[model samples]
Target chain A: MLSFSEENYLKAIYHIEQLQTEGASTNTVAKKMQTKASSVTDMLQKLADKRLVVYKKYQGALLSAKGKKIAASVIRKHRLWETFLVNKLNFSWDEVHDIAEQLEHIKSEKLIDSLDAFLEFPRVDPHGDPIPDKDGNMTKQKKVMLSTLKENQQSKLVTIKDSSDNFLRYLDKKQIAIGNTIKVIAIEPFDKSIQVQIEGREFMITEEVAENLLVEIPSLTLPKVKRTN
Target chain B: MLSFSEENYLKAIYHIEQLQTEGASTNTVAKKMQTKASSVTDMLQKLADKRLVVYKKYQGALLSAKGKKIAASVIRKHRLWETFLVNKLNFSWDEVHDIAEQLEHIKSEKLIDSLDAFLEFPRVDPHGDPIPDKDGNMTKQKKVMLSTLKENQQSKLVTIKDSSDNFLRYLDKKQIAIGNTIKVIAIEPFDKSIQVQIEGREFMITEEVAENLLVEIPSLTLPKVKRTN
Candidate 1:
């Protein structure tokens, strides 16, 4: 019977913990939520009182197992809904996030489970992020930034770290999509930009863009000499 | 953008006006909402300030044009989501209401429109209530209570005035459904209970049940005298 606001706060803390792996500090939660630090502290105390989170004096707020379960469930619902909007409703990737954000708060395990069955159990969302299972279990597939690829190193685009509409729109304009084969052909040492070939098409992507594109590299790491001016 | 509570109040007011045809009184609204009369008064004033409702002295609250539009839109979303839940997700009629209640508050015209298209532009919800169009227009289909039908008269079941899960379960148990041809074979003079033949199956229903089942009669109503002991 948690309020939507409380669920959102739990989800934010879970995401922050995932990214940092050291749990979320009050200041970091505030920054991520675009709110005041004092307000985040108040929320953290409330969640702690509910046994959803544990507040450490120095380390800030950490999600309890109960909190993690709820967070993962929300994420699961969000990804499933995004998949529905894109695959079933014909919505583009850029337009699904905010709507899914609102939809994730809809309570009812039966509804979400039914939706999961309707979508035939999607493995990943349109953004290529793996969806969590009903028990808060995630199928982990490790990915590294595309810029980390060595010259002549080939990798498969797995996910996008930044799922902003602007980023999705940029990817749409550039024809960069998940499951594409990206091979680094050259590296511009002057600006750290990477020149790559995708599906036999040559292109140069900015360093920022490359950093946002997460990819799975081949087993061998050979950082050979292949830098240009 | 109206809050979900505000949208719900507008919808309540709209329904009250539809049923009474004289708009809603503050007391009736409070009773319907299960809140205090004073709280309802505060909400009415707030709605009046927003120009969504016009509060009449000694009367009640009436929806403005804009308010009616919003209420209809919310209802449209609710009915559409209920259709999706039952039709696509394999949810039973009794199981879809609460989930659809939360989903109706989702704010995305494109999402709802896309869903409408996905559901193949449903004419009515699973409960047989007509779904409002994108512009808040509904096709008028007049219906009267089954209890009002004359003896031996036949009518097509259209909608149920009471859509509670218990009522739906009752209908399911009796195998009664929308579009079924119901013939009032006999009437009890003592309690006013009616015995109807549905799909060649003869069954006796309580007066309260007859009052909740709404239907459309053929042409002219001929009240015949066929009362039983």
Candidate 2:
């Protein structure tokens, strides 16, 4: 089994790789992990030796299949735990992250499976992030930034790009939550702040905050055509 | 915050101190941790430096007040998690221990407090071990070994002195559970094996098994005679 730190490295690299085409650079990973680049290089080399990552001297590193699997498993555990804390334990979304981080490292398939069952197999965490299934599969939802929505167009909150505690608390203060319907009322040309309607209340959010909120437009499904045989 | 390994050491030392009046010896801690004596000594010294324990030259170590509080908190977390697994997730008692071991190290006062509330403040875990309160207080139940009960005496199973998987599985096979009413029907004079009645089923159990089963004979609540005021 990998150490907790090793598992953390793999998870960091996986997220970095998702945003870029090339392998995750040591500096990028260090920035994400809030650690020294030199330390990242050392860890990359160790992971390479373990065949968990493909590390090139100057080009950075990428997770091997084995490493990716482990990383996804950790993420799965984390999202599921977060869901449990919020849905079952009455914890708010902003407060579940740190606790879930520790729970993600618990190594027990049976325990996690049992928890999944108890939580009724949630598809998304309280943050609206899609949870990875047992086989390391995540259902990618088609979502766009809230700021990108046209004026008068409505969408549902799918997930948020930023799950930082500050951002989450800000959202909470606005009474925003996953699955809430949001509509763009207008945008300020000077500062790019958007006036939006959530549930019947209208509010203005800064461009940065709007950009962090991912929203999905509802599909217009006409009545199914019935053909006579 | 203490590392998971450090917390484990404190818990082990705490258990050892309970069994013996003196401080825990390095050899005993080593046996509990399944590590080398030298490593235990090194860890003990580190703990001493942190003021979590008092370590002597060769005489072993004892937890300080701060250390004891931390140990009790960890125990509280462990037993609470075990209770959650069994009560909420439908996990068998024998399957909850290892999972709880990992969960006990999670660092979050709010999360644990929420869990305690969700579980309705259970007094004892599924294994019949009492859970420590938030203030590090444990209620010591009046209990004795089943083997010590005389013939024709009836008692209730309170807890198990041994929790090894083998022993728990054996108990499961025999349909034994905590809080079951056990009656000592007879005892073999030659071998010290006792015939026990549990839930209308009569069976023979060896003295070794009986010794591990802690039981309590209920005190009769006699009716008080009314007196003139």
In candidate 2, the residue pairs with backbone N, CA or C atoms under 3 Å apart (3 or more residues apart, or in different chains) clash, namely: none
Could you give candidate 2's per-residue lDDT for residues A126-203 as a string of tens digits?
989889999999997888898877667788999999999999999889999999999888899999999999999998
The list of candidate 2 runs beyond 4 A from truth reads A217-229, B217-229
Top-scoring candidate (TM-score): 1
Give the winner by lDDT.
2
Off by over 4 Å in 1: A221-229, B221-229
User: Which candidate has the highest DockQ of all?
Assistant: 1
Q: Interface RMSD of every candidate?
A: 0.5, 0.7
Candidate 1 local Cα displacement, residue B221, angstroms: 5.1
